[model samples]
Target chain A: MRFPLFLSALFLLLLPLTAGAQTKSINQFYRKYKHSEEVFNITVPGWLIKLGAGIAKSQAETPEERAAFQMVKKFKKLKFMVMEDHNLVTPRDYNRLISGVQSESFEELLSVRSDGARINFYIRDKQETIKNMLILVHEADSFIMVSAKTKLKLEEIADLVNQALDGDLDNEEIVPVIKPQA
Target chain B: MKTFKILLALLFVAVGFTAQAQDDAISKYFNKYLDDDRFTVVYISPKMFQLFDKMDLNLDDEEAEAIMSVVKDMRSLRILVSEETPKQFFDEAKKAFNTNSYEVLMTVRDKGGDNVEFFIKDDGGTVINELLLLVGGEDEFVLMSFVGNIDLNNISKLTEAFEGDGDDANDD
Candidate 1:
């Protein structure tokens, strides 16, 4: 009787941990695809974001530049992965990656279908505020996923995009994802 | 007793699976793309809007505060423009949206374009869940969606700041 009771208790204890493990995490995708030549991974640490913000701050002499950097300062940890090789990262692979990335906790923020690319944006919210934002850009030739750890507002990003278009930001490395509309 | 415990564990897993079955329809289009390179896409999340609330817009203190307050409700914004987008694609997009039962907020016929339709998914008449703007033109098309508790009045105010009396709109 005691053996059965103890076994049941152990199962109960392990259940939560196993449930947590099953949830798809971004780290898992990074680990799985990092080895493949098709996947190009870029991890920007908090320090790098801070450094980028600092450089942007120094470059801001004009009002437009200052306005643009204001948005850049909020970015913390950013991870970007792009599937470059079409043969390896086919539509099936893209769908699989998307399914793995989409979790119950993250809410759908935006999804757009453009000429060459289809972009999906998701966010994890805490206390009515966004804790993290995930962006999936699937193009004809490639699939790109950008995970940004931030509390910055959504419209501020649009403002930043608008500001970026104003010809203030010269730092290409930090702002690789912002594709201007023609 | 061991068997009973295993059965309970399996039940828990089944429940978890059932809970995650709800999928948003918009996600389906997030992987579709046309071969032509005549499309433009823009996505902005609510977090960025929250960041905007924190910024000093260099306007009058009252005006800035009011704008920020209106902006707080916006969650996300997505814009897609395509020059080579086909009519069938636009029709299919509209049909998908219709299936989701999004209510039309307004429709306008522009001299330059065929028609512009604005659709809104309202939440309890207090907040808007999603707002969709689809502009079908003769040559080009524009599709924009804003997800959140959006106030249309405030949106018009925000547009005025950028468009600035529509003086340069015709320059394009």
Candidate 2:
């Protein structure tokens, strides 16, 4: 009886690990290069972000600034890494990093390549909330990666922008209304 | 127990094959060049479209509304671009997919020796399953696949919206 109980306990303990094993996050890439001399990385926590947002909100003068603050406040965490030395990251590693993030369910939102420079945007969302947003920019001399975690929906941000653009931040009547296209 | 394990392995193999069989021709071609250093590739999956549907887009203007209507139906978008030997890649892409399976929507040849072609896979109706655009120029090659339940009418609306927006901006 004790042996069976032990087996069940072990299975329960290992179950969560197995569930998480499938996710290949950008954090793994960050952690790998964070210690490199040529790489610059910073991770801002949720509280710090909220504090910064508060300051920005207080200083905001225009509706656009307030709208930007509202959007920034929704982010739970932000991470950024940039490598100024092109030799630090190989082409193979960069490709692998892109593939790895895709494996983590990050869907490409936009990718633009021009004049030997490329910029890629990816987002991972669950239901109505965006869970993560990633941006990777590759140029001749440098590479940059930024990852943001949030529980905000794209429409919420869009609504904020729309309100700002309309110069009616207090107007709640401008909320999104879905009507069948005719 | 050994027999059960063997049966489970066979089941996994069968599942893998089924998934592979369902992949579209464009996707297969995209995957082939995905790891190539010369090309820049982008792929948006179906799950993103599901999320887009859930969003309450602020359709305050006619143009925004038209764009949102078309965006909601998009299942996936793939783009492959290269500046090196662009014409070669364009020719290779043309041969990779069966042209007979798609309807040629439009073809344009510019003064700069650039070629642009639009192909659509339809269900014998107004609904398009996939819209493929190929651009081959002296300095750039672009292959884009927009997969979705695209309505022909909405595409015209989208084009109109873009044209309306373009009028306010400088082209040169």
DockQ of each: 0.23, 0.24
User: What lDDT does model 1 reach?
Assistant: 0.66
Which sections of candidate 2 miss by over 4 Å? A1-27, A91-120, A138-140, A164-182, B1-23, B45-47, B110-112, B137-139, B159-172
Docking class of 1: incorrect
Every candidate's fraction of true contacts kept comes to 0.39, 0.24
lDDT of 1 by residue, B1-172 (tens): 9999999999999887654331244444533532235667676766567656545453333344456656677776666677675455566667777744478789888787577788777755556777787877777677777777777667666666556535554673
Error of 1 at B167 (Å): 9.7
Superposed on all Cα atoms, model 2 deviates from the true structure by an RMSD in Å of: 7.9
Model 2, position B113, has a per-residue lDDT of: 92
Give the distance in Å from residue B46's predicted Cα in candidate 2 to where it truly belongs: 3.6
Interface RMSD of each: 7.1, 4.0
Quote the positional error of residue B132 for candidate 2 in Å. 1.2
lDDT of 1 by residue, A31-98 (tens): 77777876678889978888888898888796667766676667778888877766245566566656
